[model samples]
Target: MELKGIHHVSAITAKAKDNYHFYTEILGMRLVKKTINQDDPSVYHLFYADEAGNPGTDLTFFEIPNAGTTYQGKGSISGTSLRVPSDSALEFWEKRLSDYNVDHGGITRQGERNVINFRDPEGQRLTLISDETNQGVKGGRVWDHSSVPAEKGIIGLGPAKLTVQDPAPTVKVLTELLTFKQTGSYPSSFKGNEDIIVFETGEGGTGAEVHLEVRNDLPKERPGRGSVHHVAFRVDNEEELAQWRDRLQTARVPNSGLVDRFYFKSLYFREPNGILFELATDGPGFATDEDMNHLGESLALPPLFEHRREEIEANLKPLDI
Candidate 1:
């Protein structure tokens, strides 16, 4: 009946090739899946994660060639965090990002934890959260294969920052409907803005929390490259997901019900602020069609799209991995 922690966060990328190099090489995450966006076969939908493409570890990007810059503002996933092992890992990353010329805001504090904010080549806002004392839904283990040493490798997704004008409706949906508990509130650091509210579910920790920020100063977001498409929460199975679909419908929440993602079953819906949310099953994972050892090495298509692989491949621009 409870949604597990975060499943994955999907964002947009203008150049899949550069996104691949940065995520896999510089950030040292594994490109676990290379496939076409099922809804639009012409572009790539790349997945990056830990040693194995575990549910909580997934960070994905949809290729949108030549997309515009995302104007920083409200009604958006303002920041996405990647969890690391400890504070020392943050030290390694600070030097690493500087060495690679990655834009960063140096290490800072978010409550008791050490956080370093940074941006990708595409200007995607990101934060590295040090999991020094995290005790809830455990983080994924990074393999020794990553360019960054195993200890410093990014483990999994952390709290997603949702910025909006009004937080009451989103808070109601998360606490009342989705069962997330309002854990706490932290300073926004920006003068005159209200403190960011924290909500958690399942085993509640860095991995299962959502941080809501109120911002009346900014306008609605103009999403483009580097913009988050949605954030999904984990469900145990399709049966559980189906029950959730019924729950949403009963409440008249208006959701995309029972989608067969092949890798996972999903039900997508948006909160009152128009930020997308998804409930996704954790099984029939990335290994469903491809061998684990060879993941992301070649193009993968779900069974329904398998017959049209030739057409799909012809349309996608080659990502030189």
Candidate 2:
């Protein structure tokens, strides 16, 4: 089956406020939408992305307040990386982080680009890299915010790196099912890691290439802060998503029953190597609630939650979007 590209990546967060602040204030992402988790209305589901709140542009989080602190282990998402236009953007980010009293590491060169590594309030490892050579090659949702100058603002997603116990099954799923092409491996600059496998879609930026590292030595990862909940890939519509669901069933890939996410429909499953995977439809998208021009400014809910807007808004902590 042909998959379009990446959708939004979702993760769990301990506190809603911290997640909101990190993704917006620190990362410079627009708080595209504020809504409650459909599965659990008591908690909030926040989406951070470009102004348009496009599928691939999003990084989402579900607030799970009482979950115990998570230990970084194997078999969980390792880190999420974002790509920028060039190394010059790193200077803006470095100064921005410093101004906010957020701590980050120095710049380091990897492959042909320079990257600056930093952690969110929740300790999720994030990087900003300058790769101007890769602009316009991939379509990105546009964000024309004054805070995010058009030039230096994030163009779109970069690869999400997964640390797995074994590479074979995951490799098979990536190559055969997901339609990712092997882009070879490289020695890792991070701790206790060796080679990293790179996979690229026809699009070549954040959502374009995903890097997988196999580390037998590290303990399995627990879900919490700094962990990726699931990575989602984009599909054109329900018809195409159904075809993918059938493909997964044929491969005996276990999956959660199809779920409607309002803006998009989703199917959740675990890859052979155990990293959670999601297949999500691209639209009817963020424009469903607020107009595209006013998205992410206030609470936006699906029709299901529209009736409960007052209650949901009351329960959610106030955030500056």
- Please tell me which predicted candidate would have the highest TM-score against the true structure: 1
Q: Candidate 1 lDDT, tens digit per residue, 123-238? A: 99999999998988889989568899999999999999999999999999999889799989989979989999999999989899999999999999999999999999999999
Could you give candidate 2's per-residue lDDT for residues 14-43 as a string of tens digits? 888877777766676877778888988878
Q: What lDDT does the true structure give each of the candidates?
A: 0.93, 0.76
Against the correct fold, how does model 1 do in TM-score?
0.98
* Model 1, runs deviating above 4 Å: none
In model 2, which regions exceed 4 Å deviation? 135-142, 190-192
Candidate 2 global CA lDDT score:
0.76
**236: Cα error in model 1, Å:** 0.6
lDDT of model 1, residue 128 = 99
Worst 10 residues of 2 by lDDT: 133-142
